[model samples]
Target: MNESLLGALRRAVGEPHVLTGDDCAPFLTDWRKVVTGRAAAVVRPGTTGQVRDVVRACLEHGTPIVPQGGNTGQVAGATPDQSGRAIVLQLGRMNRIRAIDAENDTLVAEAGCVLQAVQEAARAAGRLFPLSLGAEGTCLIGGNLATNAGGTQVLRYGNARELTLGLEVVTAEGEVWNGLRALRKDNTGYDLRDLYIGSEGTLGVITAATLKLFPLPAAQRTAFAATASIEQAVALLARARSMLGAELTGFELMSAVALELVPKHFPDQRLPLPAAPWFVLLETSDAEGESRASERFDALLSAALEAGEINDAAVAQTMAQSKAFWHLRESITLAVAAEGKCAKHDISIPTSRMAAFVTTTDRLLQERFAGVRSATFGHLGDGNLHYNILQPKGQDARSFAATQQDLSLLVHDRVRDHGGSISAEQGIGGLRTADLQRYEDPVKIALLRRIKQALDPRGLMNPGKVLPWQTMP
Candidate 1:
């Protein structure tokens, strides 16, 4: 950038806040480290007004802005392009829990606030923020909202979009839209809050959000079980949902290969059940006491075993044990990461078609690529599965990379055949732009383009991230 633009940025957000060269190195790469980018400069604005000023200065200079939060995104969405001309607008400095209304069951949090911080704040106020995920410790609420993130509790609570009540957004042109209403019912006009929540920062910068909270559950129970197959796991989820009702908070499915990987990578973690073709980690929460929840869990598992829905079961005896069971579920990703490079698909289908999708995809991978390894696991209740395939044994890195595009096409085609989404929770970042274009409807794509043009006329807001690159006429 020119010296004049740097001067303007320094004036907007102080000289200390404007980072350059080595100071901006840490923010250049994404969390996964797969895609690295170069930025002209990194700007950290401390307040909403500062964000507006920075946006205005960037507009005046005609510099592209990449709005980034904690940078824990799986896709390279937060990273800048290779051009090294865009300004990296980091939001970490704006962290704050603005308000908490316990009676109203709502809390206002700034975009840069870590997700776990928001959860803890809600807990301090005798409420629950219900959006739980693996990167809750480092991921920011802004990125979560931008991605419409879904976690284990999504089956009961919902995704980030559902938990959000309103937003305070800074437009691409430096205009701040204060739509942070905490009201439950507002049918006044078009719902603009939903538009920016999952737009992945293409539309605007989400400064803060008014989020919904729930009464904290008095008691919770976690259980681990082994099932005969993926089909049995699906059946058990259906039965558990019917029997447990609102108490059924989570129901995760894991293949035997996933289970084995956990112990192989993390020696401290132990499997709760014997070796089986499939496993499930489930949890139930209620306002009632532990005894009641325990009895319900035991009865449900016994009934499932008798009905052949599950082969074996183990209910967590204590809180520590419960966390240990959850640890096994959480460690699957890290274990897979330890193994090697793999092609991962975060796709979802109808809950009923999950079993079929798994069976079909497994067969195709084995037949087409001999000796390849597969690990399929995710929230069975919501139908979102993280299906990953590792390179076949002794395969060269170059050869494995060559199969990614073809494998992605095969996985996405099967998902489409089952009326499933290629991206269930993760947003369409730079990684999946081409896949999105290939799968998404042309009419929908055209409408998205029109909206993009209307909101970001200059195409300066996180260009080439969410939407595929297109010349706006």
Candidate 2:
């Protein structure tokens, strides 16, 4: 960038907030370290006004801007390009919980407020913010919205898009759109809020948001159930949902390989039925009381056990035990990361066909690619699965990585064959840009481009993230 542009950026956000060279190194690489890039500078804007000013300055300089929050994204959605022409617009300084309306069950949180912090704030207000993920401690609500993140509790509370009531965004043209209404219903002509939610920052920068909240559950029960097969796990899920109804908050499935990694990686971790072919970490919650919740959980599991759907079961006796049960589920990602380099697929299929997809995909991987290990697990209640494959033991990491694209194609092609999405939760960052073009419908792709062009004509807002510059034929 020219000196004049640098000076303008420095003026927009103070000199101390404008980071350059080594100061920008950390933000250049993504959380997974899969995507790395170079940035002209990293700008820390303290407020929404400052964010707008920074955007205006970048636009004036004809420099692209990549908006980032928390930087805990699985895909490289927030990373800049290798050209080093983009400025990293880091929102950590805007971390603030603006307001908590207890009566309305709503809270206004800034873009950089940690997701766990928002949850705690809601809890302090005697409410619940239902978005729960493994990286909640550091992931920001802004990036969650940008990717339309879906976590374990999505079955109960819906994804990030549904949790949001309104958004405050800084458009690509450097205009602030304050659509931060806390109302539950409005017959608005056009719902622009939905446009930016999963746009992956390619549309505009999300600054703050009015989020929906719910009454905190009065009682909760978590249980780890073992099944003979994935099909049995699906049957157990149906039984739990049918019996527990709204009280069922989570239904997660993990293959034996996934469970084995926890103890292998996290030494302190332990599971009662680690050798089970498949395990479902399920939970039930009620507003009535703990006694009633416990009774329901036990009754449902007993029925499942009697029906032979579950081979074994363990219910959390205390809060600590409940957390431990959840820890087993949450630790899968970290454990897998510790294991070795693997190709990951966050895809979804019909709830009924999940077992068949897994069976078929596992067989295909074994038949086509010899000696690869698959660790499969995810939010079974919502039909999303994280199917990851580790390279054969003693295999060269570089040689194995060279086959990533081919391996991904094999899994994604099966996902398409089974009428599933290539991406269930994680958005198409620079990593899956080509996949989006290949798998997404041409008509939908065209519409997406039109919307992108309409909102970001100059294509300066996180260029080359979600949508490609040219429409796919």
Candidate 3:
């Protein structure tokens, strides 16, 4: 960065908040520990206007700028490149809940506010934010909305995009786009808020948001059931939907391998089953308290078992037991990470085709990469499957990592053939940008490029992160 640009940035955010050298180290890497980059400085802006001024100053000096939130992204979307001339526009100090409208059931919060804080604020107001995720405690709302995050509760409340009401953004040229309207019914032209929702910051930076809220459920019933196969799991979900409808909040699949990994890594979690090939964690919530809800849930499982939709199933006897059972399911991600390097895939298929998708992928994978253990699991309710492959024991994990691109192409091609998405919940960041460009509709890709060119013509906002500027041929 030039001395003039540095001086203007200092003027916008103040010298104490401006970080260089060692201070810029943390913003250079993402949570996955995948890639690291160099930034000239990390500027922490305390307000949206300050962010705007910093951006404008950077634009004037012709210096590149990268807008970052909590930096907990899996795809390295927020990490800058090795240019070292780019400034990391950290929004950490922009954290604040501006206002909450209990009557209209909406809340306005800054981009840097933690997702968990938003949830808690809603809870305190006797409402539910409904955008729950594994990284809710650390991930920023801007990042979640940016990626259109899908969580375990997506079966009920929908993705982060649906839960969002409006957005406030700073465009590449430091112009403000105040699209934050909290109204539910707006026939406003173009639906511009959506443009920035999942654009991965290639167009503009999200400064704040107005989010929709829901009535808190009066009761919740959670269960962990063992199923014979993926087919059985799907059938069980169909039956549950017929009975519970929107009240059915979560339905997560857990293979035996995933369950085993938890106990192997986490200290307190226990294993109850004698190791089955598959399992399911089903959850339901309702606005009214009814003990019969739990009874009905058990009955649904019983029906599934008798109909052979599933072979065996179990319902938690208490809240503690329910949490304990869920501990096994939630720990799968961390446990898998502890096992060392592996090629992880997050893909989606049509809900009706999930069973066939799993069977085909599993069979094909087991056939090709000998001893490459595939621990298939995740939000089967929404067709989002975590098709992760583990390296063989007594072999180098790095060897398996080398085949990631080929495996990704094969997997994404299958998904595309089935009219499924290459990426389901996660956005196409650095990890999947090439695959996205290769498989996404040519016309759609063209439009995306046009939008990027119009808004961020300089390619200064998180460059080389989402859209592929050139075809790989």
lDDT of all predictions: 0.90, 0.91, 0.83
Q: Using TM-score, rank the candidates from best to worst.
A: 2, 1, 3
lDDT of 2 by residue, 156-237 (tens): 9999999999999999999999999998897787998888899999989999999999999999999898999988888988
Tens-digit lDDT string for candidate 1 (100-214)? 9999999999999999999999999999999998888889999999999998999999999999999999999899999899999999898999999899999899999999999
Per-model TM-score versus the true fold: 0.98, 0.98, 0.96
What's the true lDDT of residue 66 in model 2?
A: 94
* Model 2 deviation from the true structure expressed as Cα RMSD, one decimal place: 1.2
**Global CA lDDT computed for model 1:** 0.90
Q: In model 1, which regions exceed 4 Å deviation? A: 471-473
Superior by lDDT: candidate 1 or candidate 2 = 2
User: What overall lDDT, based on C-alpha atoms, would model 2 receive against the true structure?
Assistant: 0.91
Can you give the lDDT of residue 371 in candidate 2? 82
Question: Model 3: which residue pairs collide?
Answer: none
lDDT of 1 at 399: 94
Clashes of each: 0, 0, 0
